[model samples]
Target: MRPLIIFILFYLLCIQVQAKTLQKTVNENTISFDYTWQDHSHKTQTLSFSLPKKLINNKYRRFKRYDKDKAMNHIYKALLEQASSYNPREVRVQFKQQYSQLSYTIKSKSEKKINEVEQKLKQLENKTYLDFLKQHHYIEFNTPWAGTKIKPDHKNFVIEGVDYLEPVTQAIRESISVKKPRVLINFVLSWLQSIPYSTLESRTESSGLGYYPPIRVIAQNIGDCDSKMTLMSAIIKKIYPRLSQSLIYLPQHALIGFQLPTLKTDKYTTINGLHYILAEPVGPAKYPLSEIADSSIGYIDAKSYFHEII
Candidate 1:
């Protein structure tokens, strides 16, 4: 009986030790995990953990240390991967305690569409930028417009504005047999021109200080020069992730430019040794790709400068 009792106690001790080792492993490696949902209200929630090393691994297993920025990126990618499988209504994420006990619910139609666009993007992941442009030039995008009243700060307007993804996706889906890169660009230019022009001053007077989100611009069917350029820029970046692009700012006007294989004009700007063809997005005035407005050309030549979008 004494021997049997000792054996039972030893077994229990082993099991407890195993559990502690597992918990220690988890607590020492994981930094944080995030949960995001896409429904009518776009929402994201993050749970943080303190650990010595980053637990997340890329496909190559290259990243093995915890970096706050890199970890956030990993979490976002993970959420995007999971979100693709859900319908465009309500998306949910739940994490077990062992994994970092977290739950996120996002309700936003626009967010769902964005996830769908991302899924489509995965199909072209292996293709080169030029190849992707050639293959998807004529794909038509069909996403309903959704407007937000929130004002965008300068930084928000430039780098982080993802609301444009949905409409841009829709535009890609709606594209017709556009084989050439120039022709594809024209399609986006035409779409921007179709939106009615509203000046920043006038928009601010009525709606207070805020830039329209790209999706909002589509829903409202009107935008200022900055808003229009922002929307166009977002679309261009989505299509050509590897291309060098920038924002050109004049005294009172803003435009975007892209680096192509060949230069169409000497009137271009160079950033990081890449020449970008200046393209105007604000129009009722028809300007071809790489053609700046005649009035703005001199201003651009004299006082315009470029800001690289990274």
Candidate 2:
């Protein structure tokens, strides 16, 4: 009786990406488990699973495995579907066992339409977007960590305020001798830059802005890709935004493309040929969306997997 009660309680905590974790205690042929559930849905749910003194799972039936979140979800859905058929007005469930009869309750909210379940699923998915970006090379880099900048396509990119960007090629003219690639500051600048990354966690409104300048960006250093690209276009409007091939890549090898752009870039006009100056992030390079990624690991791209204008 106690084991049966435990099975039912353990099943409830398996939903919403919570893993179905079970612990088993053994004595002779009997196996008893007190499955403790935590780390999901904001509560502690526990139950005990016991097998008949003789029937043990030593047969290696991995289907009985419980660590999988998917399996936990399946168990949860099964429990809910089974529970739904019981009419609260018609029946009451109570059990007596030495381990103590623990009661389970399905809150009124759980009985809501399937759409509510979908909403919960969406919330879980939404929580994963930024994490996804961090695990993939979502942004692209043009050159290796240490290399001369590649000349881009011919075109002028636009800047709303700055009419004409004085062009300057990347030249190590000042330092004819490259430093022997010494590790400056005990680690990479990424560890020390204190660069702030952001998303629309809190925004009053959103809309389209055609073109902007770097002054605001230099000042606030915050804005969406819309303004980011707009500023990129403005800076390089005199150049071109290449469509066929990636305009940039890192020594590690990566790429992305801009359509035709037209701009006042810090460098030569028409760098993109269509005037779209490079719109890469001021700090870290973002990978293109085409790349397969898992943000459960740390990777980055300006392109968002969640959804975006570009």
Candidate 3:
């Protein structure tokens, strides 16, 4: 009896996984995606879009893995290589933990020698920091977003991911009969919301990559708040090239806001004399423009969230 119950649970889990798999039909010329989702009105809608196969092959041929320890090791090796380039007998550099913080210690035969070595190390460290981020395809960010400690390169995701999605954005634009800003934005949101929602793991976790870039999110048909926001930002940018945008990070969730006309009842934030009407694009729960998850309202109302211009 116990075995039967366990087997049933396993079967249910398998069904859930299979259901989330995106249905795509690939041909020599293009890859077509068919999606069905419910709109804010609780009405079911279907969308079909296709991407030129060549675009996928040429533009997003690889998915990058984000591993903090691996990246740190690479940086450490670089530092050691730089240090070895100096006369080992004259200068030595060591990394040590003091009061629960790690810092560099320099040793030399004389104070003058140590000072010289320190200057060189400083220059190398600065250059290495930027190089490591580039090599790892990450951008540095600091935020208090929930379930996050190491900053994921969300800026890189937004800026870079936007380029590959023009074909998709154009397809969406053509599908919508009404070209109104709200209408198009809501349509995009509903499509994203319908995709399987996967919780973003912490970067510190060794088991999974915490953040998914926009293209990866679409390819996998699963995303959390940050990933969806990144995709939405890219789509909105393509649709309205001149539109100003910002990404809002709440304690455990994320949302996007656009610099556009607003009404008295709209939820918005002001930056540099511009109004950004906030929109919640991360949904299995439909939130139309000017609406956000109830969980996020306290953070938004109290202004206790981080905001970044994209």
Candidate 4:
């Protein structure tokens, strides 16, 4: 798995007043939200969405922070249970603990027992690790070349987030009042840009301050660059599942790009012979599709950034 590295790139722009047109109404079983933001053309755009109270109250949306030690301990417990199934007289299971790490050793008078335990442990390790990540709504990703990292499970996140966010796309359709592809995308981008910005610490080292799943971005009302990008990707994917997308990572920031026809002035990167028009959803400063922040432009122009397609 490749770890998606994150850097905290700060901008001097003002945090847009997100509460200007915010409205929320709760019923017996659901919470309905309404928000408004100005598009690039200075026209006001409004969208409303409702989510089940039970869904929001569930364990997943409530907890955004990840604990590495706790995860390892969970895996260790599962392995212990698997290893203990064998006869202790012939098979011995040992552990060495140092801080957050837990290492294990399996010994036996019979070489076959050792092999059996080893093989079983391998299976258990993969199973338990995948289970923990899935349960926690996290994904272990690999870098393009060779490396592993952790991030939220983008695919599953999109699948679940799309249901509750259906209204978002619908409202977008209503706001535009037509099926103009470019205007539709820009509308979504501007709306996301209007959301107040939050910072994520080093993604490699920690989940940081405000890395949220797509639903939480709506429920909690804040997200960093990567968090917002993921939410936007999910929304766009729901609208156009066949559209190709990528997550472009810079020194301390992240962006989402779409593969589509482009004008000469549009900023894009070519990957595998496909062109992805880069868009900056991290805002208070609005930019439409085929454009990104000046800072992002620098990294891309220098060929110092990398991307992971979704």
Candidate 5:
């Protein structure tokens, strides 16, 4: 009986020590992780961020099954949300089981630099507007005038614009050397917004029978929602051939969507096992890459398309 009692006490002491060690680990607030990847420019970069212990504990307890992959995905999703707020042009996250590690890469054009370019653009706005008018030979015509009616095969038109937008593609590549898709999309958005907005009826003078090619839209410096979205889609397809993109038809309006690895918000749709976030191209109002306007939500009827440059 004496030997048994001694054994039981020793076991209890060991249990207490183990529990204390676990408590110490759980109380730690941060986990250090190393991230390494190549940027859009093919330059290798490394960075780090603190993974919150609280998040891990909460997810672990809730998942109960404690799937490492699921837990890692949650971590990646959180990291994505945090990174996106800073408006990185591109971000990719991966998990490696060999080291029980997470790695990610971000390519972001500095906001300060973009802002400086914006200032310069603003300074030249008046001159640019005048130049556009003079070069395009602006003409004002009556709205809804009986212009020639032509039914556009929308898909074919968009596909054909791939070859037609070479000049615009060249201009984009030259102006912004960063090849990050999101940043390039934003750059396109800014350029489209710079053009004055006009309805198809107003510009074409043929109500409900007006569709212009992407190049025509650019040269004229005016277009409706669909025209701008078509231009954006063409430019994106030309530049990032591998990235998945789509045209979302919403009520009488149109928007663009791009497939991303993971999206935290409900404002997305899945296509062929990939997630795509909605982006507005017809904006005097600036919207982020995947964000839609408040008025445009819940009434959306989206369609997905994958265009190959070949």
Candidate 6:
């Protein structure tokens, strides 16, 4: 009886473990949607939606803001409609935790149709976002994104508003003196210098990247917190493709992980003997290029930038 019970439990556990697999493949032109949901059994069910670049950030993407089940259903519906146009066999979702990653499957008929629907949804989303952009007309200043003039002499609008551009735009500005990361350092630096700290709100919702460019962060230098973070992150990602999440994310706010070539902040990077440092400039403090790794407030990355309050 004991042997039979053990065998039964083992069989059920195997079925559970095999339910998910690798979610998706990354490419130059791929857009992914990952969200959690509740299955019929009321257990958490995760789904990863990977569609072709035809639709990157579309209207359907906003469903993430709604209820989880609703968002999952919306994505599933779109993928189903898309499958009608092509041939998709399965969709995959990965379950991520502190220690493990597992994936699940969505039976489908066509991959091409999924791409088509995704593109359509992306076009819709872009149109809506663009329309919103057209409605606002002011530059903002908040935190490190501050200091630039709202209406620049050349660009007309600025993000971090300083009267002039800088030699380096990101946290690791000091590193520019020693090494170059293969992209336009000055251009990105100018953007970092252009963030409007004064005009931005203190809070914004985060993206998967742990940054926000909320509506508040946008049009007004505030929107989703992730968008603002993206402004900073985009530069880093452009430079280091395989980098891990920086140790320093924000002041008094715990955010997501991203790639960084150096450990210039209070946060350390376990890479290449720790090559560089940069400040996690978020609020009213000034972080010098040298004191980035200082382990305290008013200092930079040496302290825990992602310390959560709750």
The prediction achieving the highest TM-score against the true structure is 4
lDDT of each: 0.51, 0.29, 0.76, 0.78, 0.53, 0.34
lDDT of 2 at 264: 32
Clashes of each: 17, 77, 1, 11, 0, 68
Q: Candidates 1 and 3: which is better by lDDT? A: 3
Stretches of candidate 4 off by over 4 Å are 1-16, 143-147, 302-306
Model 1 global lDDT (CA atoms, 0 to 1): 0.51
lDDT tens digits, residue span 1-310, model 3: 6999999999998567446435688888998887766688987767777777776666544645565566656666777788778787888888754443335889888999889888887887668767876766665555554343445567666777677787778778887899999899988988888787888665433223646678777766778888899899988987887889999877667889999899998988777788899898777788888887778888877878777887
**Superposed model 6: Cα runs more than 4 Å off:** 1-66, 69-190, 197-220, 223-226, 239-251, 254-276, 281-310
lDDT of 5 by residue, 113-228 (tens): 55654454344433443343333322122212333322233444466677655655766676666877776776677556545556544323232234455655554445677678
Q: Score candidate 6 by lDDT.
A: 0.34
Name the regions of candidate 5 deviating beyond 4 angstroms.
1-151, 200-208, 301-310
Per residue, candidate 4 scores C-alpha lDDT tens digits across 1-310 of 3333222222212323545656778999998888877888888878887778887777255656567887889989998887777788889898776898888898888899889888988888889888988888787765543357777666677667767677677766776666766777888899888888887666665743357878778877778888898889888887887888888876578888898899999999888899899999888788989878787887777767667677
RMSD of 1: 28.3
Q: How would you encode candidate 6's per-residue C-alpha lDDT over 85-170 as one tens digit per residue?
A: 43333533222223222122333366764465556656644454334323332222233432322210111212222211121123
Give the runs in model 3 whose Cα sits over 4 Å from its true position.
Answer: 1-22, 52-65, 88-90, 94-105, 144-149, 203-208
TM-score of each: 0.46, 0.22, 0.82, 0.86, 0.45, 0.30
Instruction: Assess the local accuracy of residue 159 in candidate 5 as a C-alpha lDDT between 0 and 100.
Output: 62
> Ten consecutive residues with minimal summed lDDT in candidate 4?
6-15
Rank list by lDDT: 4, 3, 5, 1, 6, 2
Best by lDDT: 4
Put down candidate 2 lDDT per residue, 1-310, tens digits, no spaces. 6998888777664342222334446777655544343311223434443444432332111211112244234434444454556566543223222332222333333445344444554454444432332222122113324332212111112322224322200111111234221111011111111122233211111111211123333223343332343333333332322232223322222222343332332111122343322223322333222222233112223321111112
Error of 3 at 252 (Å): 0.9
Candidate 1 lDDT over 1-310, as tens digits, reads 6999999999998566334322223345443222121111122211122322331232112311122243334444555565566664554433322243223444545776657555554443323322422222111111112222211233234444444364344445454365466666766675566455777643222222334545455534567776788777776666665766776655456778778766555356666787777777877665668777777787656544435463
How well does candidate 5 match the true structure in TM-score terms?
0.45
Regions of candidate 2 where Cα sits further than 4 Å from its true position: 1-164, 167-196, 200-205, 208-213, 239-256, 259-310
Candidate 1 lDDT at 134 equals 28
